[model samples]
Target: MSICKIYFSLFLVSSFLTFLLSIYFLILDFSLIIELNLLEFNSSSLVMSILFDWISLLFMSFVLFISSMVIFYSEEYMAGDIYLSRFILLVVMFVFSMMLLIISPNLISILLGWDGLGLVSYCLVIYYQNAKSFNAGMLTALSNRIGDVALLMCIAWMMNYGSWNYIYYLEFMKFDWIMGLISYLVVLAALTKSAQIPFSAWLPAAMAAPTPVSALVHSSTLVTAGVYLLIRFNFSFSENLMILLLFISSLTMFMSGLGANFEFDLKKIIALSTLSQLGLMLSILSLGDYYLAFFHLLIHALFKALLFMCAGSIIHNLGNCQDIRFMGGLINQMPLTCSFFNICNFSLCGVPFFSGFYSKDLIVEVMSMGILNVYIYLVFYLSIGLTVCYSFRLSYYTMTGDFNYLGLNSLSEYSFIMLKGMGGLILFVIFSGSLLMWLVFPVPFFVCLPFFLKLMALLMVSLGIWLGYCMAKLKLNYNLSSLDYLTLSSFLGSMWNLPIISGLGVNYYPIYSGEIYTKIFDQGWTEYYGGQNLGKNLSKFSKFLQLLSNNHLKVYFMLMVGWIFFLVLNIY
Candidate 1:
């Protein structure tokens, strides 16, 4: 009857439902036979399948398990928030939508579920309704819409080719221009959805939402949507555009990794790290190796979610302060939290004997197969190095620093329940390396290699940890405003402090010229950056439309004459 009891009941109900689905998925997983059905109904032929495939069921199982855990986590996590009822509703809706997305029979249903998930996530993002949260929600929703539009374009293209079904899309393997267009559109969709390249601006801004929102959206679900889409469309995607896709993925990984390097906000840095890692996943997806990519996705989701949740716990305990500069020596005050955070962070670095090690090695191993294009291999390797840079930066600064408590009077430890949840996830990240290797690829020799990728992973993690610790020892202030000034001074110099750089750089004489040419062309970069000023500048255009509105009688007479002219021409 109480609020907690009601939410607990709902969580239990959702967990039970997912458990049932997982059972069904497992049954399908063990069954070797895949039943394909070609049925004609309602004047349309439909090709559907009982997806008893190993990969689909495996991913479904992980999704169900993670959703259930998130439900449990939210039970305590969202207790303080006022909109608990609405939050629970959206959370349940998200789980339902994701279930539909993962198990949909056709592209249309998958898209429907994908769009639903996006909508619910937007609702979650704006749950606080503060100006900052609202702005974040709008940006997230808008960026996702860009991806949604790309997906729609791809769907339309596929429909025109009469291959709305993914299976059919794969079966028709002629690799035509239409297919290429669809592939490119899908990649664009993935890039935007996963917060890659230019579209990545929205994600770090998305940290304005609640901590749970960051955890759920960035770590486990929304950021992974694009990766999941790539996996779902694997057969179609892997055919011929692998090299081009590898190049783009490499660029995204590098750029986002650098962005994370420059960022100081804990959430923003992790957000960028998420983008970079997702780029790595996309790179693996480009290789057409579904098993490796999917496994990596699973491990990444587990540990990344754990890290985000730990970060949330830290922020919550510290009175909602998210800046790393204000946090230091938290391990002394909150040992359990620090330990769990470190476990997840180390897992993120792909330290040998961790789950990240196994999954990341798989991806790098596959990249090494690109003998002719060793450039891809180098990018992949460099991405791992960047991963170390950001991951260690996150760990040492927040968890193991010089007790830089920013005048906070009290610090509370994380709840036992939260620690228990984190501990479970940490265990997963610790041991799932061996579990996944044995389950997916049971080759003993391949699993047990020391002088190869494991050694590389260990060396990278150590070097990163040492370098980051040394950098932190120098007591570098992890403040963005300072870094911004430094960057502007170094990169922009005299242009840095200008009131309006573009405006100052422009030639005003062109605007002053007594010709209509300026009106036609010289709106300039200011118009793009400052749309309100652009509207003010374009008042003349508005006045012209106003004049048309004012002279409706003349406009009607002109329309009548035009109509008469058309009629006379037709008669002629």
Candidate 2:
């Protein structure tokens, strides 16, 4: 069998096993939740509930299903590649780890599974091993490690107070400083893992990986880790802590929305949009609305995966060109691909009657319910507008306008296998939201509104597309810089180090203005502030460390001689 066939088979097996497991969990309706044992010798056994819950099991099923689809999609998407075997192995490993992590009952087990998942994701990101891809892989690894450490610390802190099981803590937990710390750390971990502000840079860089990898990363697993964590432990987050999470998440959502709007690279636009969606998820999670967040996650995964796959087809057909400037009139050449693209893009904008509309409306309703505060409502609506804007921008650039592709004749339709996968995903993206609406949270008006929202979003997206098309047709240059910057800044977060001061706090800011002034003026008789120059100051710090190391080496040599003398005396 071919490598592609092997990978496809592996994906099917993994997906089927996970689906069976989810069903098994659903079937085993456990009567008892907590079975704890305490003994005189001091060991305690706390067995929290493990049977499937409506929310968690539903999410687990989606993760399994989406992952399988992406894997199947990859069979065609990544065909003819040399590392097909390695890709298949790593992807299957990723699917396994993600599934295990989500279903684990205890925090310790979850962390262990999460660590493995993170490692596999990193491997997948750098699967190409090119310079840029490698960098993206390294950055993703570092960011995820930071998140893992925070989660570990939170778990350790919780264990100190005897709360290792996730389900038990949610029900029996009380608000305290340790709990607050854990909540904050967990939020941080979630934000980083989900590619929220400040930690979002790596995601755009991650576009350097293969399109299949992007489809996998965005839709099913990696970025969703933080969200899964948040929802899994919703009860433990507490009230005030949830409020804080809501604030941060809202801010992240607003920013990422703008950042995605301004991006030009097809993959990076999707990456930024994924970050925005994560922020939205975080915002909802903070409201203690786990159901809404999970549902939205499901919808987002289906549509986002569709978008990425569609983008992949376009790029593949166009000879690997990713910039929108080189793509135009692609609709004529690849009608099905364009159709799928439109479906996913419409879903992204949250058009009524679409899957995105239902999920997004639920989120909006959750915010309106105001489990946290009135401010959350504002953030939600603002994010809604921003979401519409960015989604429109994405659709406008790729699907609409004049045939400006430099080498027009070079373009061709995507391969048969690729079309098959894209077609399946497009169908899902179009129908999943509507299906889930009836299945999970049934409401007549709510279900109906999504169709309208989808239409409205489509109208807005069409307007943008038309404007872009006209510019191309007339050969009039419309600079997208302003839009691009809006997107870029939203995700960029304080242009390097500014946020360290503003967001984290002045006490922790690496570069202190007051310290520089003190060093310049407070030095004996020196009237000038040479310390104001950052370059010279860093050089001096480097020299100071060097001197300290030199003195330490001399002390080490004397200590070695003393050790030798003591040994000689003992021998005598």
Candidate 3:
């Protein structure tokens, strides 16, 4: 077997073993902490530690499982690449880094894993060696670097306690004034990793990576690292900070949903959806329901991974065409692929009985019951509705509408290895919600609300479907290409110009400043003063000295006689 295959098999086996161990821990309600002193000073020590509990174990299992399937999928998807082994090695290292983050209780150790994620993800993003990939990789790395710096600041702030293990200090630090800075930094770090709001540009741009990397990094493990961090540090947040987090997260959710509705590229649309779901997770976490946030995070990982896989299968067969405008009636040609796609879409919409329903529905219901601001309530519900809106819109454009492709396309499930990889997650997409709910929540959530509020989610879903169908039908029937219509279309279609705002808006000034600096300091002033002018002056002085030293003995004698004459004059 090839090394990739060997690693894939090994990962699969490890996933199963980890899942079993997770179940064992859940049954026993067990936890373990292991610590070793690495180095000691007078009053401080560098220590490495691991915290093994239900949460970490369960999360680790899911990470391993998803990674194994992604590796299996990539075997076919990345088949012809010369650096396939290197790619596989990078993925394995990514998993190992994630495991380190999952198990570590100390902030110092977490930095190791955290930096590893950022570095590895950058490598993965630029794997294709294209200009687009290079730009996306830089965006990915630099955005995450913000969080890395924030975490470093957090570690420095944490030194006030003389220990780097945050778990031990969360309760005591909850009311500490110093914790305000730490909490802010923590939330900032989480926001960056989760791609919330201002940090969102990189998430969609990162679609330049291979599909399997998208499935593993963007969908499941890497993005959720922020949500996981907040879950761990939930106690350290004050009420005001939580509210601020809620506001940002809700806005992020609504913004992504709005952007997804306007998007046409297949992978970018899904990437936007992932952003929206991340917003949802963060909002729930901000609401202080850490368990529900974690629940939805895991469930989202499953369906989103499947969703990306289905999209990958379609793109693979369509000769890399990702524009949904050029796609239609794929369901007729690729029945199984469309079926998986639709199921994953509906799951994302939180249709009843699907994996998302168990977590998302509960999150909405709980939000409804809470005494939240009216705007928060509206944003949450409206974002939920928009999820269905864009989902149905996507389905309409890609699956049921008239055939839109210009040329003959082979939309079939010929990639059996990819299908097999997706098949592994399909079952979980259908049932993981219930399975996780049963395992994680021993006590059921108690939700009491008015009938209309209870039906609000369903009502929005129905409305979204109707609107999507109407919009698709209208496009087919009429020429809606007036200037005004086109303007509005562009606005909504471009994610409210978030790509411009976050991508170009945030970058333009710095890039402009860099240009100025390069011209003035690097190429202009520094060259003249530091390099060219200094060299010219030194060369002129050397020439003058050489002229005075002329290689003849007569020249030397003349200089000595001149010096003696000047000395005699001075003496006289």
Candidate 4:
């Protein structure tokens, strides 16, 4: 077997082992915390610790399982590449980094994993070695770097606690002023990592990566890291901070949903949907249900991974075309791929009995019961509706609509290896939510909601479907060129100009400042006074000294006599 295959099999075996271990921990309600002293000095020591509770174990198992499947999927998707082994190695390193992040309870050790994730993900993002990948990789790295720096500041603030293990200090430091600042910084880090609100541009741009990388990134490891961090640190947040987080997350959810509704790129649409789901997870976490957030995160990972894989299959068969406008009637041509795509889409929309329903329905009900502002309530519900809206729109544009491709296309289930990888996650997409709900929430949720509120989910979904169908059925010749419509479409289609804001708007000032610095300091003052001028003066002085040395003997004797006379005069 090839090395990739060998590694894939090994990871699959490990995932099974980890799953078994997680189940044991879950059933017994047992946790094991291990701390090893990596460095020791007077009154201080650098320590590494791992927390192996059911949460960590289960999360680790899911991450490993998904990673294994992605590796398998890439075997076919990434075939014919000369650096296939290197790609697999980088992926393995990514999995290892995620495991490190999952298990570590100490902030110091967590930085190792966190930085590893950023660095490795940058490598993966730029794997294709193209200008688009390069730009996207830079955006991805630099955006996540904000979180990295925030985490570093957090570590500095955490030094006041005499230990770097945050789990031990969350309660005691909750009310401390320093801890409050740390909490804010923690939220900032989480926001950036989760691609919430202003930090969301990078997520869509990162779709320049290969589809397998997109599946892994969007599903399990990179984006969910922030949610996992907040889950681990839920005890440290104050009510005011939670309120702030709630508002920001709600806005992010609404924004991404709105953006997804107008998006056309197949992968970017899914990427935006991932952003919206992340916003949902963060909002729930802010509402003080870390378990629900984690549940949704896990469930989202399953369906979203399958969704991306199916998209990849379609794109592969469509000769690398990702524009949904050029795709239509694929359901008749690729029935299996379309079926998987529809199932995943329905799961994403939270249709009853699907994996998303168990988590999403409960989330909406819980939010309804909570003491929240009307705007937040509206945004959440509308965002939910928009999810269905875009899903149906995407389905119409790509699946059941007229065949719009200009040339003959081969749409079939020829890539069985890719299908097998997707098949592994399809099973989980259908049942993981129910399974996780049973395992995580032994006590059921008590939801006392009114009829209208209870039916709100279904109502929005129905409305979304109707709107999507109407929009899709509109004639191609219909003119949408009016200023008002164009304005609204541009705003929504450009993700409310978030890409511009985060991409160009944020970088404009810094880049301008850098140019000014180069002109004033590097080329002007530094070059004149510190470099070129100094060198020029030194050269003149050296030339004068050489001239003096080349003087004739009479001139040298006269100079010696003058010096002797001056010395005698000084002595007198």
Candidate 5:
């Protein structure tokens, strides 16, 4: 209790201060890079760079803010856990790492935070210490290591400029192949970290973590780190890379949204929604509307954290049951949590005047007006519908019906401490969109599109709400449409077989060949010709030497006979 209180106070105070500072910096249109030379050896200057731009400070504030809420919530949610202190420490470490990432513009410094996120996140994902958590943690870690390697390559690529501070060279890397290489590496790093497309399986898989950790990770810290990195380096992307990012992020957006609609796990549904939003951020960033992307990102952090918090509350009330299929009519029992959940869902669906609308509606308009092909346009809007489709489906399945899943007592709404933490952010989730929009952009983004194009956002949202209601309206006796088209449902539900692809498809051959190589080399021919054969030969030689040393009859006889035969042959 004392530890949680202490950290919560620290994070909360820091968040308020940084958020105020971000506002100050934004009004001044100012950015300051504080460079402390950690080491200056010859041509290489290793500097600990702290960037205090509006973006970094603002994002840092959000990270700290959400982290405080999560820690506060975990106090109640994780109340009886023996290692609560340890869990709190891991969360603090995660927030600290994210802060480090937020403030650093240097690639080397970023890696310190980048690698910290991977290591600490893996620890969080496996906090339960169960087989499922263990597997999720492994997948999360290995998948992120790919990004770690890519960031290392970015560092290496930046070495050509005689400095690791890539911020000083964003434009330089744009036209030149040397710098373009860094951009490619950065994109790859971001893709893996953000869980886009092929690397996406880890995001949902990481639901094995506690809900508080999920609130921190899937919302504000680890997943958004990639989006933040790309936001900083948005200027460096080449035309070809931008196009490719659009396609991949669009698909990731669609795939995750589709997966969520088919998913039954409450936490996984939220996780998948996060995946979809990440793709949205990346997609808009690719469209060269990074300000709006960052806006959506901040707004997303607010609600997604709350979404996970509410999900955690429900899951706790259900006695750790995460299936939405078993949940119904929770609104009467858990009215506050249900209200927060649906508000977040409405925000997620970009309902008018809500926090999500200010950012998301703007992004949709911008994308609609941007120079893009028909395929991208379609995927973009379809992903939006799928997002709402899943959110409403999740709401319907969990909140609309009776509390008959576990028992009446299991679904009580008495956890005020948890609700207290959630209350701190609920107002922000509702109004931060308009509030931040007014602050972040002095003059609004004016996009000129046709009447029908403007209607698309609403149309898709309405369609999604209708479809979600229809889908979740199924009775226990109703056969799931998902069950009818098992193959397609499985494909979509499994993230288009990405987990299998990134898991088995990626692992099978290397493991298979590794086993073969192990047998043929380490355990077979190499063993025969290297260590074992050498040992056998050495043993034989040692025995022969022992016979000579022992003055054995056969050894002595052979030696004496050979000496005599040599002497006789020399005389002849």
Candidate 6:
């Protein structure tokens, strides 16, 4: 009937069917690969390959499920917009591109999907058409282009093997330095795609898009593409490369975690949390357990999608206001939405028995069981603590204090459609942790350590809560004591303002050179010689014509005589 209903039904049915199929594949330990010979040439058979395994099927199911919810959610979320159908089309394309990526093991096929993601995400990010959206979209597209180039180079390099399907050579890449270069390239692509330290600016800036797009892109599709690729290429990484990834992931985690504490924009705060969690996923993957990485990935996706949806509801009800400082006492008005928000925040903090707890606890124990040096150990635990810190800080600001924003009486949870969309996910976010753990990892990891070591996770979480309370504490009496530590709140001590420092530094030189070239070549040379000079000559000729043709018959006769003289000369 309606546009949202059509897409919702389609994606919902697909999600259900694929989820069952994924279970089947998982239980039977089965994978189906189909190859179509596109061209048969001399010593090479270029083929299109599609691989159906539990990972692809399950990931597709998740994408479909989230899409269904988002589309259904948009029934209300985007009802006022005139371009609703166009937005729906963009979202559909995004989900399908993600599915295409999930199924393809061939580098060429993966490129089709990979490039689709980059292009569609750019369009979606710029959908609002404001300067902020335009800038964010450009940043997103250009940053991802680096990864696209790396993937393209990877395809060219794989041509030496006479096949684009690197799935067959996963183990071989570990042994050969030449193929190992491909792994390095793939890692480079993943790092850029996943928004690792240097490339991470685009992730938060992309919040300029609609909240629904943020939910889909940041949660399960665009950002996860990189981590999923790494998981697929897990066996291919050399030990040295893995260690390098470990350090980079650690830095990314620490950076984002610290950044979130300073962020006031609610969507940006959640986006930063997504980046932090992604760093956690990559860090675990680098430590040689791709399963834990995927586990955390799925777990994070569930709660995060719901988290973003809840955030969207809050922003929508607040008349597009996203600043948390102006929002308070939401629990008194929009109790249901606040409940959902707090639950998601708790899950994010990896509170015991929640969905994030199962996977995060496992990962933490796995890291603890391993012999790691001091810096890595502290970074991992501290980042985890920071995760809790930001989440607590967000909740304390939004739900605990008096309503300080303009629309105090206007706040209410009349968004049944949006709540219904979030309703589809809350159960999964709460319970999927244990279910997935039992299903995927039957043999639990034995985390044997001393009593103090075992209590470290609890300690970090407690410290995070205390720090969050301190940051969010009200300074009603002009607390001079708190002002003394303003450095940590505003300047170098906080995220080191790194989203600016790290993200901007890489683009500074190239952007500066382009500006200089625009001024010198474009404005100075091209403007004067190409368009400006042409316009000047045309203006002079037009002035002569205007001078001659001041509604005078004599001028007209003179022009006619001149034309006749020119014609006579040409004829002669």
- Among the numbered candidates, top TM-score falls to 5
> For model 3, how does the per-residue alpha-carbon lDDT over 151-207 read when each residue is reduced to its tens digit?
999999999998888999888878998888898999999999999877888998899
- Weakest lDDT window of 10 consecutive positions for candidate 3: 476-485
Model 2 CA deviation exceeding 4 Å by range: 3-51, 161-163, 369-375, 442-572
**Per-residue lDDT over 1-572 for candidate 1, one digit per residue giving the tens place of the 0 to 100 score:** 54544544565565456445545544455543243557878877755434445555556556555555555566677777777777767876776777666665466766787798789888888887898778677777877888888878877887876666665666475376777777778778887778766566667777876666677676556778788877766666645577777677777787776556545578877777787788888887787676677778888887887888888788878877877877888887888888888887778888778888888876776566444375776677777777787777777788765767666457767476666556656777788788877776645424444467546655666766676666556655444444355553222211122212222223355556735554444565644557756677689789999999999999999999999999999999
The model with the greater TM-score, 3 or 4, is 4
lDDT of each: 0.69, 0.70, 0.87, 0.88, 0.89, 0.88
Worst 10 residues of 6 by lDDT: 475-484
What's the CA error at residue 134 for candidate 2, in Å?
2.6
Pairs in clash, predicted candidate 5? 328-401, 329-401
Candidates in order, TM-scores: namely 0.77, 0.75, 0.90, 0.91, 0.92, 0.87
Candidate 6, 1-572: lDDT as tens digits: 98899999999999999989999999999999998888998997777899999989988888899889988998899989999999999999998889889999999889998999999999999988999899888888988999999999999889888788899998965698768899999999999889997788788889999989999998899999999999999898999999999999989999889878877889989999998999999999999899999989998999999999999999998889998888888899898888889888989999999999999878888899894788989998999899998899899999987987894357878889999999999999999899989878767777898899888888999999998888778422222124243555554223445445545566788899999999987788888998889999999999988877776798778889999999999999
**Where's the lowest-lDDT run of ten residues in candidate 5?**
475-484
Backbone collisions counted per model: 0, 14, 0, 0, 2, 0
Candidate 6 wrongly placed segments (more than 4 Å): 37-46, 474-488, 491-572
Ranking by TM-score: 5, 4, 3, 6, 1, 2
Q: What is the per-residue lDDT of model 5 for residues 400-472, given as tens digits with 9 covering 90 to 100?
A: 7676575546567889989999999999999899899889899977889989998999999999989888777
Candidate 4 — what's its lDDT?
A: 0.88
Ranking by lDDT: 5, 4, 6, 3, 2, 1
What is the model-wide C-alpha lDDT for candidate 3? 0.87
Candidate 4 per-residue lDDT, tens place, 476-544, comes to 332222334347766776777877788778889999999999998889888898888999999999998
Lowest-sum lDDT 10-residue window in model 1:
492-501
**Candidate 5: lDDT of 83?**
95
**How big is the positional error of residue 183 in model 3, measured in Å on the Cα after superposition?**
1.6
